[model samples]
Target chain A: MVNDNILGIIAGILTSLAMLPQLLKVLKEKNVDDLSPLMLITLILGLSLWVWYGVFKRELPIIYSNAFAVLVNLSLLSCYFLYRKSG
Target chain B: MVNDNILGIIAGILTSLAMLPQLLKVLKEKNVDDLSPLMLITLILGLSLWVWYGVFKRELPIIYSNAFAVLVNLSLLSCYFLYRKSG
Candidate 1:
């Protein structure tokens, strides 16, 4: 059986880490130009739901990771918007 | 109060949708070159955890979203590895 505490911690770190490639790609390429609006909009909604689910469950890992994901998504979205506006 | 069923459905759609940006960006840019292995590794772990969390809560949204997210992550990771190998 998996240790619940360790699993939660590992899950948190990994989930957050998953954002890195997108973050790095956006940062390195500076080309959020092709990112879709529907995608971002949907993701934000999803993240919002995850956050709500976390709160309902009182699970810190879900709460923290999804919250952080919202920020990452927002940041990426903002960059995408900026790219569009500038272009 | 929000309808839990509706919320779960919305959450599932949103979470899955969230992966679109990354998918599109990777697709368009064809540059998973800079993606980090540690990040991919961590994300898989997190996604797995989220899936478990979903199972525990009996939440369809979490299950579907995280499952989809895992595929998205794996696809991206495979591309990154290919990029790394090629260059």
Candidate 2:
């Protein structure tokens, strides 16, 4: 059986990196017309809450994952604003 | 102090609904130029793992949230494929 820790780590890593591709795409294309600001804002809010919950639970995986996610999402939001005018 | 369960539930709901706006945007615009398929795939994989981890931990919040996330992600994936050609 897969260890729970391993599962958590994998899930955490996956969740953390899930937005990386989207961020990269926006950076490369320098356009975010197809992206939605509301989506990013909602995601960031949710992730921030997750970070708080993780801290409260003392779950290292959750804390680290959501923290990383928040960073990625912030970058995405920045890109949206930066390139939105070009689009 | 806020209850841990309440935090978990709120986090779960937030996480689950985070993608709803994105999905709606894609549906409305019928374009996914800014969206990356890899992101959706990675997110779904992560959410699936979270569901498994939640089951192992016997955490209802985790299971329900991730399960809902998986459904939303699947919809996004379908949208990505469907609308990508239009872009």
Candidate 3:
């Protein structure tokens, strides 16, 4: 049987890394028309909560994943505005 | 101090609901030119793992949030293909 935390770690890593492709795309294309600001805002908010929850639960995987997610989402959010303004 | 599970629940709800506007926009606009198929695919995979993690942990909030998220992401994925094909 698979360990649950191991699964969680894998899930967390994938989920966090999932932002890379989109971020890179946006950076390369310099377009944010398809990315919704509201979605980014809500995602950041949700990710913040996840970080806090992980902290409270003493779950390192959860904390690490969400913490990194917050950074990636923040980068995307900033890029959205930056690219939109410049483009 | 705030309850961790409460935070988790709220995070889950927001994260799950975060997909709504994008999905709605895609459905109404019938255009997915900006959406990345690779991102959608990875998101679905990550969400699936999260669902399994929730199940192993027996965390209802995680399960519910991720399960709903899976459906929403799947819808987005299908819409990506459908609209891509149609448009």
Best by TM-score: 3
Q: Who wins the lDDT comparison?
A: 3
Q: Model 1: per-residue lDDT, tens digit, A1-87?
A: 765556666777777777767867887788875567778778887887878877876777778877888888888888887766553
Please report the candidate that would top DockQ against the real structure: 3
TM-scores (chain A) of the candidates: 0.86, 0.88, 0.87
| TM-score of every candidate | 0.75, 0.85, 0.89
Computed on alpha carbons, the lDDT of every model, listed in order, comes to 0.75, 0.83, 0.84
Model 2: per-residue Cα lDDT over B9-80, one tens digit each:
988777667777777877898877666788788889998998998899787877888899899889988988
Collision pairs in model 1: A14-B42
Error of 3 at B69 (Å): 1.1
Flag regions of model 3 displaced more than 4 Å. none
C-alpha lDDT (0 to 100) for residue B23 of candidate 2: 74
Q: Score the docking of each candidate (DockQ).
A: 0.58, 0.69, 0.72
Error of 1 at A87 (Å): 3.7
Worst 10 residues of 2 chain B by lDDT: B78-87
How big is the positional error of residue B54 in model 1, measured in Å on the Cα after superposition?
Answer: 2.9
Cα-based lDDT at residue A18, candidate 2: 82
Worst 10 residues of 1 chain B by lDDT: B78-87
Model no. 1, DockQ: 0.58
Q: TM-score of each model's B chain?
A: 0.82, 0.87, 0.87
lDDT by residue (tens digit), candidate 3, B7-87: 999999878777788788888998887677887778789889988998887777778888888888788888888878652
Q: What is model 2's C-alpha RMSD?
A: 2.6
